[model samples]
Structure formats: structure tokens, C-alpha cells
Target chain A: MSRPLLVILLSIAGAGSIVLALVVGTYPISVLQVIETIVAPAPGVVHDVVWQLRAPRVLAAFACGGLLALAGALLQVLLRNALADPYVLGVSGGAALGALVAMLLGAGDTGVSFLALAGALGSIVVVFGLTFRGGDWNVYRLLLTGVVLSAGLSACVSLILVLAPQAQVKGMLFWLMGDLAYAGSPVYAWLILAVLTALAVAQGIRLDLLAAGELKALSLGVAVTPLKLAVFFGAALATAAAVTLGGAIGFVGLMAAHAVRLLGVSHHRALLPLAVLLGGSLITLADTAARTAWAPQQLPVGVLIALVGVPAMLWLLGRRN
Target chain B: MPGVLSCRHLRLQVPGRMLCGDVSVTFEPGQMWAILGRNGCGKTTLVHALAGLDRAAGAAVELDGVVLANTPRRRRARDVGVLLQQEETEFWGSVLDYVLLGRFPHADSWTGFSREDETRATQALETVELAPLSARRYVSLSGGERQRARIAQLLAQDPRAFLLDEPLQHLDLQHQARVLARFQQLVRDERRLVAMVLHDALWPGRYCTHALLIYDGGALASGASREVLTRANLERLYAAPLAEVSYDGGSYFVPHV
Candidate 1:
């Protein structure tokens, strides 16, 4: 398929998923009601359900998905590893530990989000400091550092989970598994996604060159050190924003970029937008299914995404080869 | 449009092994230099240092009488083009797109490459005889084809000086001669500076104006091709006896078993 056609289809799917999320909730609102609520706002049960409750959740899911996938794409390039994801740098592990500790401390939802963001930022700074020691961008060292830190953080998270009270343990687990129950607003998520996406697209050509190889990129006139720094920080910030908003969601980051590439779009110029759209749509639909799959007993959206995304990605990759 | 890429009192080493000792050379326009050395003698290392991608304990390289280290990466790239010996690339772009990346130094950073850049890339592919495979994935190409693709990228770069590491690694004899002839034409017609690390002695003697022989033990010899590429010097450089044969008014060295 042509690039524009694929982009159009992904956009349509994204729009459709948002509408599906609004209409398929426990309230049993019709699609038309969801459309009417969006097109012409009025103070009614449909408006209250669609605008007040589902809008923020759906938008947050989309933004979080976009952010994670974008981060994943950038990290894949920076580390030059195909399996590199947003959380490979231990950012999400740090965020998970923070959110769980907040729960253990009897903190509110706001406190959990704040601490998660803080933890993610801390991870970003520390990893960057250690990886860039002696002012060199060593790809293998960065990967090793991130993996070791992630393992350490995950162990701490497990310790906290084991020590927490039974009542708070469930909430902690929900956060760790990624829940959108208290994602009050997606303003920060959208802001980070928009700014990062624009910046990434603007540097798309350079990113493409960087993917070729660092020495090759430098020889071709790229400021490789600065570009690598920018990519690392940009991916970190995107991951931090997503973790703060939607907990430690998985699969979207790893799979979305791969999906876009499997569909024959590899250039960053085309890859970034299509991956963002596909990721947003995938998570929006997955969240919708998570909420309504077993009505009144919501499954963790992260679990649903992994369960669906793994097989889909495997099939896509398997078919390609 | 032409400039000198010269290094002053440069020391190149790899850990405990010294590649070269305080080697100073000036590569002027209209000069095609062939760097000959045995394996693991740091021929590639010297190229990297000259390209300003690496700096050992020594004076910095200078391009057009300006310090290369202080030059901005984009500006330096517009002036010098380097072809690395080995590639650790995960690039999934088409060959045409891969070649077009060479035009990046000239690109308008925000808007990407121009139509003229595309034309240059396509023409480069045509020059390398990879035009038919322009749409193929770069990684999917054969070894020789990928080497040609890299050469195409360097051609598209169109820098004043070309520093190529082992430019004929995977080429067949036909391609080997053709690529050398192309670089020879580039130097003769465009007055570009060409410096390449070559394993074979025949092509350099045929095509190059000057030769820099980097022996293994921190020894260096560089001057006119005829002066530096003697059978005595080459046999010592490789630690193997060689038989010199003159064919078509060109001297060729063959290793003696």
C-alpha cells in the first residue's frame, strides 16, 4: 500500500476507536449519541457519560500510546537494537516502584502520579549520567546499564509488593499492570506527544542517518553526539509522560513501531506519524475492550494489550519472512 | 571548491600497538593517494583520524588551513567524505534513499533533501551500476552490491576530499578496475582529493599519484607512488617477499610464496 493510504486508514481507525470507546461503555450509549455529544454538546446523560467520563480516559489512552510508541522508536534507534522499548531504559520500572511506594504510603492518586513522574525523571538522569560517562555515547554500555537498572528496580518493586498490606496491594498491582481508572486529564500527555513528535519529525532525516551507524552519520555531517543526546532525552521524556498518565503500559511501545515498519514504512518521516496513529488506535481499542470485555470487572489494559499485540505482531512478522 | 586535508605530527595507536609515529602528510587537490599496509596495521585508524572522527595524542587535522576539530560537523562533512571499512548498519531504507543520505551535508536541515539531491543520488547509483537495484532494501543487497551502494553514497556526497577505507573489499576484478577508474576520473576531471586504503599494489600503482605505506612497527613511508611503492619497501611492509612485474608500462607487485 502507498504511504498516504496507510496513513489515512490508520487515522480513520484511530477516530473509529475513540468513538467505539465512548459508545461501548457500561452506559450503553449509541454511536450516534456519542457523535452527537461530540458534535453538539448538551447537558444530558449522553453528554455526561461521553464528555465527562470517557473523553478524558480515551484521550489519555491515545496520548499515552502515542508517547510510548514514539519513545520506543527513538530508543530503538539510539540503542541500535530492535527489541529496545521505552521501558528498556528502566524508566517505567522506576515509575512503577514510585507508584507502588506511594500506594504503600497511603498517598492519593495525585501523589502517585507526581511520584511516578519524579521517579521516571530520576531514572532518565541517572541512566544518562552513567551511560555517557567520559562523554561517549556507547550503545552497548547504555543497553547494559538500562537492563541492570531495570532488573534492580523491578526487584525493589517486587519487595514492596510483598511487604504491602493486602488492601493496598491490589491498587499497587493495578497501577503496575497499567490502569486508566484515575487518569483525570491528558493535557500533559498530549502536550509532550505533540512537541516531541514535531521535533522528531523535523529531525527525521538526521534520525535516518543516525540509524545507518554513528560513525557513518558523523562522516555524513551529522552532529552525532548531540543528536544521540536529544534522542535519548526525548525518548525518556515521552516515557515519563506516559508512565505518569497511564501507569506502566507495555506492548504499545514495542509493537507499534514494529507494526509500522512491517507495513513497509521505515523512514522516520513516515514511520513516526503512522506508528503514533496505530499505537493510539490500538490502545484506545484495547482499553475499550478491557473495560467492556467483562462488564463491571475491568481487566488491566496492559494485560489485554500484550495478549492481543503479541500474536498480532508475531503473525505480521512471521508473514513477512 | 578544492581544499587540502592534511594532518600534522599525528600519532595513531590502538591500545598497546602503535600504528604510525608522528606522520605528517598534505593531500592536495588533483592528487589521488593510495594508503597501503598489511592487515591490522591501522590503515583504517589513520583514515578515521584524518576524517576528524577520531583524534589520537597529537596535533589535529586541518582542512583548507582551518582546524578540522573546530569546524562544525556539517561544514566538515560538506568538505570531506569518508567511506568506512566496515559497516554496522541497521538501515532499512532503499538503496536510493541510502545514497541520498550523502547529500545531507548540503540539505536544508529543516525541509530535508532537495530534488537536485535526489537527482544526484540517482545519478550516483547509475554511476555505480546499481540503478536497477535502487528500490531494493540496502540490507538485502549482496556484499559486492552493498559495497557499490556505499561507493554510490560517497559519490553523491561530492566532497572535496574522499577518504575511503578498503574501497575494493568485495568487488570482482571488473568492478575493482572500474571503481578505481571512476575515482581516477574524479581526481583528473574534478580535481578532488582521493585517499584510499588498498590491500593490493597493482591498482594503486596504476591509478594513484602518491602512496603512503604504513608498516606495522610504527614506520611510515610516503612520497610519489613510484618512490614509496618499490618492491623492497612493499616486501618489508608486508613481511613477505614480492616479485615485481612490469605490464603495460605499470609496475605490479605479486607476493612470493
Candidate 2:
């Protein structure tokens, strides 16, 4: 596909998904009704359903999806590994553990978000402390540390599930599987996504040089140490924001970045934006499908994300081969 | 004064061995220096040290009489360029894009390269006879073509000094000669310094004005081609070998097998 065509298609996909999510729900708002609510507001069932409930939820999902995909693309270049994802560094694992604990204590959604945010930040600090030593960023060491930390944290999560009473298990599982049922506000997520994406895109050339190798980048006049520090912390913060908002949504980061690359967008400038668009659109559509798939008995959006992203990626890869 | 790269009382060592010891050398413009040594003699290590990509313990390399370690990386890169023997990282861009990265030190903006940068990169590709493969994916190129592409990238860098490690690794005989002659022309015409690690003793005598012969056990010999690059020094450098073959007022070393 030509670059412009891909851009147009992705933009249409994003806008179309948002419109579809706004129009399709339990209240059965028509497309015309959705347009009317946007153009002229009234205090009624349509306004309550469209503006009060679904709109914020849809926006949150979009912001979270963009954040995760951006983080994934950054981590892949930072580690020079194709398999790197937002959760690969134990940020989501920590958030999951924190969320499960909050649910077990019977705290409300706000408390869970707060604790999850704390846990995610804590994970970032720990990994940053361990991997950065002697003024050097050890890329492989960071990977190993994150993988091990994730394994340990997940073990703790499993223990919590086993020890908790039967009643709380389902809720805990839903949170672990990523429930955006009570995503507090899209405002913070949007802020983070916007700032970080702009920063990453601005450094696109340096990022491209970095993917070649640290020494190679330095030889070409890049300040490797500072750039690595920026990328590491930026990716960790983005992952933290998304995990806190969406309860550890998986595969959006990995799938979106790889999908963009597989579509032949090699440069970071084009790749980052396209990944963000594809990811945001994907999660919005997945959330819509998850809620309406069973009508009043919704599946976790995280599960649907994997379900949708995995097959699409496989199809993309298969077509390439 | 601002164009010389030199080291004073430098030493390099691995865990159990010393690569080089107490070696001091100065490289001036308009001369191509050949770093010739057998495998494991630390030619790569020395090039890396001179480029300031790696440190030589307690010793600092000076470029224009300023410590390289203290200089800002971008300024150092503007002055010096290095090509490693091998790179483990994978690049997914086109050959032209790869070469354009050589102009990075000259770039100031966060946006794309300027038209001048693109023109220089294209000219570099043409210099290496790779203009036809400019748009080809870098990874898809054959080994020799990739080697040529890297050479083009170094040329595009347009640094004051070039430090190349085994630059002729995978090239055919024709490419080897062509690449050597290009570097020679850069030294002669553009007055750019060129230092390359080479395996063939014959090419240095024919093409180089200066040579550094590194022997095992921390021994070092360096001077003009006549003084430091003799048949005896070549024998000592390799610990095996040689017959001196003269052709058209130039000397060449052949390994006696």
C-alpha cells in the first residue's frame, strides 16, 4: 500500500470505529440520534446514554490503546527486540497485583486506579534503579530484570487469587483480564498519550539510528546514554498510564507496532502515528464488540483485544510470507 | 593543529591479556595509515580507542590536542568517523536511508535531513557504484554490496578522519581495489585522514604512506611506509611469512607458505 492510502485507510478506520461505538449500544441509539445528540444536546435518555456513559468510556479506551502502542513501539526500538511489549517490563504485572489487592479489600474503582498507578510507578522506579548503573543503560539486563520481576509479581497475583474468597475471585479475574467498566476519566490518559507521542515522534531520526545499535548511534553523534534514559523512562511512564487506566490491557502494544511494521512503515515518524491510530481504533472496536457480544453480560475488553489482534496479526504475517 | 588524532602512552587489555602497551602515535591529515596485524593483535581495539568509542584504561586520546573523553559526542563525531568490523544490530531501512544517517552530525533539527544531506548521501552511493541500488532494502543486499553501502555511509559522513576496521571483509577483488583507491583519493585530494585495518601486506606498501605494525605481546612499530613497513617488520608482525615482490618501484610482501 502507498503511504497516503494507508494513512487515509487508518484514519477512516479510527473515525469509523468511534462512530460505530457511539451508535451501537444497549439503548439502541440510531446513527441519526447520535449525530443529533452531538449537534444539539437535550436532557433525555439519548443524552444520558450517549454523553454520560459511552462517550467517556470510548475515549478512555482510545487513549489507553494509543498509549500502550506508543510504549510498545518505543520499547521494541529501545531493546532492539520485536517481541517487546508494554507489559514486558513488569509494569502491568505490578498494576495487576495492585488492582487485585484493592478488589480483594472491597475498594471501589477509584481506589483501584490509585493503587494500580502507585504499583506501576513503583515498578518503573525499581527497574530503572536496577538496570541503570555506572552511567550505562544495559539493555539486556533491563530485559532480564523486567521478565524476572514480571514472573515474580504474577506468582504473587496467583497466590492472591487462590487465597481470596470465592465471591471476589470473579471480579478479581475481570480486573486482571482488563475491565474498563469504570475507567474514571479519559483526561489524564489523553494528556499522557499526547505528550509522549509528540516526544517520541520528535526523536524519530535518533530512534531510527538507535535501532541500528548503541555504538552506531553514538558514532553518528547521538548522545546514546541520555537518549536511552529518555526512551526507557518514557516507555515506562506510558505503560504505567495505560495499565492504570485499563487494568493491564495486553497485546495492543505488541500487535499495533508489529502490524504497522508489517504494513511496511519502517521510519519511526510514520510508524509511531500509524501504530497509535491502529491501536486506538482497535481497542475502541474491541470494547464495543465485547460489551455487545453478549448483551448486558459483557466480556472483558482485554480478552477481545487479544482475540481481535492475534488473528489480524497472524493474517498480516501470513500474507507477507 | 585541530585536525590531528593522537594518543600518548596508551595501553589496552582484556581480562587476562594486554592488547597493546605504552604505545604513542600521531596521525596527520593527507596520509592514509594502515593498521596491519594478524588476528587477535588488537587492530580493532586500537581503532575503537582512537575513535573514542572504547576507552584505553587511564589513557585519553586527543583530537586537536583536546581529550576525546571530555569533548561532546556530536563535536567528536563531526571530526571523526569509524566503521566497525561487524555490527550485531539490524537495520531495516533502505540503502539510501542508511547512508543518510552518515549526515546526522551535520543535522540540527528534529525533522528530516536537508536537501544538501540527501545530495551528499546520493553522491556517496554513486562513488561506491551503488547508485542503482539506492532504494534497495539494506538487509536484502548481498554481503559485498552491504560492505559497499557501509563505505558509502562513511563517505557521506564527511568526517575529517576515517577509522575503518577490516573494510574489505566481504568484497570481491575488484571492489577491494576500488574501495582502496577511493580512500587513497580522499587522502590525496580531499586531505582527509584514513586509517584502515587490513590483512593483506601487499596493499599497504602500494597504497599507504604510513603504517602501524602491531605484534603480539604488546610490541608496536610505526612510521612512514619505508621505515616501519619492511619485510622484516612484516615477518615479525605475522610471526610467519614472506617474500618481497617489487613491481613498478613499489614493494609487496607475500607469505611464504
The candidate scoring highest on lDDT is 1
Off by more than 4 A, model 1: B55-59
Chain B TM-score in each of the candidates: 0.96, 0.96
Across residues A1-321, which tens digit of lDDT does each residue of candidate 2 receive? 667888999999988888889999878889888889989998899999999899998988898899999999999999999899999899999898888888889899998998898889888888888888989977899999999999999999999999999999988888788778868898989998999999999999999989988888878888888899999889999998888888878899888988887787778988898999999999999999988989889899999999878888889999942
Model 1 residue A270 CA deviation (Å) reads 1.2
lDDT of 2 by residue, B1-257 (tens): 34798989878666688887777999999989999988988888888888888844334689888898787887888899999788767788789989998888888747578999999999999998999999887888999999899999989989999999999999999999999999999899888899999999888998999999888888888999989888889998888879989899878889887
Candidate 1, B250: how far from true, in Å? 2.2
The collision pairs in model 1 are none
Badly placed stretches (over 4 Å) of model 2 are: A39-44, B55-59
The CA lDDT of each predicted structure is 0.89, 0.89
Candidate 1 chain A: worst 10 consecutive residues by lDDT? A176-185
Taking all chains together, each candidate's TM-score versus the true structure is: 0.97, 0.96
What's the true lDDT of residue B213 in model 2? 86
Give the fraction of true interface contacts kept by model 2: 0.70
What value of lDDT does candidate 1 attain over all alpha carbons? 0.89
